[model samples]
Target: MTRRSATLAVAGALIVALVAVASFFNLPYVVYSPGPVEDTLGEWNGQQVIRVDGADTFPTEGVLDLTTVGVTSADAELDLLTALRAWLDPDRAVVPRELVYPEGTTAEQSRQQNAAMLANSQQNAEVAALRKLGYDVPEKVVVDAVVEGAPADGVLEPGDVVVSVDGTPVAAPEDVVDAVTAHEPGETVQFVVDRDGEQLTEDITTIAADDDGRALVGFQPTPGFDLPVDIQIGIDDRIGGPSAGMIFAVAIYDTLTPGALLDGKHIAGTGEITADGEVGPIGGIQQKIAAANHDGAELFLAPASNCDEAVEGNNGDMRVVPVETLDDAVTTIESFVAGDTEDLASCPAS
Candidate 1:
């Protein structure tokens, strides 16, 4: 062969080998794409997603979908070709693996965390929905986690219900914080906790907060509620997260109420909900918006904090309503059903 032709052939071979290697090389990123949109008012695996007992439920019309984003597993390897494809697709997103999984986190640990978050979200959703309907849900402060080497590390354990602190009754998680912060650093504080239905008292010295000078017990507390009614949420075991709290609350409210909230219109949303009806921002808002739009959602409810991302990700196929609270969502849905769109908050409002 001629020298020029031989060089050209070698270059072509190198290019082919590079392409093959690129296709097989694993990237340190994760891909996120539009996932399934499940209607809380409908059924999953032939069973109602939301079932309430000890209350009268009326037949509801329309869809109240809780949108989700399909994320690559914590341990899943993404090749260069797959990453490139995800980057090119406007509906898909590529994020660093560390951002999603963090350092030293195993796939099993990630799944456990997600499951715990999902369980807590479901409990909070029920509380929010029931309280909005005039039902009382009494709550107590429960220990969720204790920081190692901290003051409460050996004293407090998870699942221990904080009944009181320094003889002050603890009704909520904030109560525990307030009780702890009321004392100065190095002061020993008494905590009465319930462990496995048995009452126990323990004392631990307080430590100064790293960010501020306030006293801290060095443990995370979450609200534990005694729900007035029995509400069961049937969702796939594969889907686990707190982002569906807002939609779960709304769906439960609709089931308990006498009228249809959506009025046969299709709607989808994503947000973490507090017991006080506040809507919190969640991850993967862009991918969720794409999922909702593709799943035939006529209107989408987005947390106000996520409005900017939602607007940027939207394809203009569906209207995106920005909601700050559960009340805002109900009001928006009611207005939409009534055909009154004036004064409603929308993403990219101009």
Candidate 2:
């Protein structure tokens, strides 16, 4: 072989080795891509997504789709090549791994936390929908967890139904917090709880929070509501997160009331909703937008705080409207159906 040909072969061999090494080098980063988008008004896994029993349900048209972003598992290792590919792809993103998996958090722990958040989101969505339809949702504060080595560690166990605090009837978790903070750090607070059909009274001392001087009982309280009707959502077990709460609430409210909310127009949305109908921002708005557009969504509902990112991610074909509450979303739907889109709020231009 010629001398130049031999040197060229050796350089090509070195390039191949470098590429092979780069593909195997792991990085502390994860990729975000378009995930599955479910139509809450339709069926999933051959089952109705939303079932409303003991209450009147109206016929829903079109789709009230909830969009999700595909994320890597907490413990999944990503190589340099994978990260670079995602970064170069317009529909994908490369973000720090710690954003999804916190420090010292295991993959199993992340799954459990996501599952718990999904459960809470379902409950809050139902409550918001019921309240939107002018139904009262009475709540009771229950002991969710007791901090270890805290003042209420032994006295207040998880699953205890709180009846009253210091002779005052408490209906919500905020009421209990208010009562606890009403007293000084070392003051004793009496709690009446119902455990397994047995009513018991216990007095626990409070401790001062390090950052704030407010008194704390060192126990987490979860609100248990007395829902007027049963609303079951058949979401796949594989999907978990609080981002779907707003879409769920809209679907539930539409199911219970008369007329269709979507009006045969395809719409997609994502937001974390509160019991009182407040909408909150979520991560991976760009990937979700790409998924919705790919699925041919005509319109999208974006949380007000996520407007900038949502706008930047838009493909210019689908219209993205910003919503601050569930009511705002309903109004946007109504206006869109009526063809009065001039006054509808949208994200600023990129």
Candidate 3:
């Protein structure tokens, strides 16, 4: 070959080698970093997510809304991104974000950081609201226990209100969770509680950590409350988020009352119910319909606003009864449980 041709060939070979190296190394120029791949989306605080109570809103008491709400944080987002990257390419080296970490971080660290951030957000909201109302809302001691996994594992037990831990008084829910997590498993911890409005003391042994060496308490503290009306309302004051809680409360109330709203039939629904009896829309209407169908729910109830999504997503396989008000949800559920309408077509889809 000519000298000129030989020089061009060598240059081409060098270029190809560089490209290959970049791609294999996952160099920024060769393979662009993909944007956020969300495994789970956070809930919106001050926003209501609603669901209908049952198949037909007639017989069922009404819509059930979720009252617990959460706010988003930038740190939480970064933490999620870091987790996703670690999961996608564990062995690969990752450039640090805002934090200066010359050494690589473990998945556990990322998770803890995210949890602390979220807990802080929740604590801040609680504190600000409580202080505004001139009431003292004590921090709750949080324990995470697995059922059948440990002695402390179970839903927040009755009459368990955390007053202090290890002689250190906690003022925020996050503080309690942080303090409890400070100890390793198998350590005995002292907890001061206000049980049934009475001051009490208890010593509970922490359980062994699960697969992860992280200590497990086997139970979480459900925050106890001693507060004025404003503080009480503030805790429950998530905007548009109380629909499900309202519905559940109403259903329980209805069931406990002289007449029955369930009518002995399995009914399921989603919607937000206001304290004043207003019904609101909720997300995942289609997914919820699928869940109800899978569970053999006789009728599915959804908000009137979410009716379109439900109908479009279900493809006419399920009965989606839509309602505008909590009263409407109740009336519809009542009608269904009474066995008046057997045809699903009769109920309005949207």
| lDDT of candidates 1 onward, in order | 0.89, 0.90, 0.47
- The superposed Cα distance between candidate 1 and the true structure at residue 18, in angstroms, equals 1.5
What is the C-alpha lDDT profile of model 2 across 237-292, one tens digit per residue? 87888999999999998888889878899999999999999999999888888889
| Candidate 2 lDDT score at position 263 | 86
Q: After superposition, how far is residue 296 of candidate 1 from its true place, in Å?
A: 1.0
Backbone N/Cα/C clashes per model:
0, 0, 41
Clashing pairs in model 1, backbone N/Cα/C closer than 3 A: none
| Candidate 1 lDDT over residue span 74-189, tens digit each | 87799998999999999999999998899888889999999999998898899999999998888888999999999899888999999989998988888888888999999999
Per-residue accuracy of model 3 over 1-350 as CA lDDT, tens digit each: 99999999999999988766544442111111211111001122442221223212222333232222122222323343443454464222233333321235454554465454333333333333333324454445433323565655443354466778789887656666677678888787777866567767767677666586665556555443342322111122222222243244344334324455565555666665543345567644544555455455566667777776654343244467777655566577777777765542323442
**Per-prediction TM-score:** 0.85, 0.89, 0.34
Minimum summed lDDT over a 10-residue window in model 2 is located at 309-318
After superposing candidate 3, which stretches have Cα over 4 Å from the reference? Answer: 1-243, 315-317, 342-350
Which pairs clash in the backbone of model 2?
Answer: none
Model 1 bad stretches (over 4 Å): 1-12, 145-158, 177-189, 195-198, 202-220, 314-316
Give me the runs in candidate 2 sitting further than 4 Å from their true place. Answer: 1-4, 147-157, 178-188, 195-198, 204-218, 314-316, 348-350
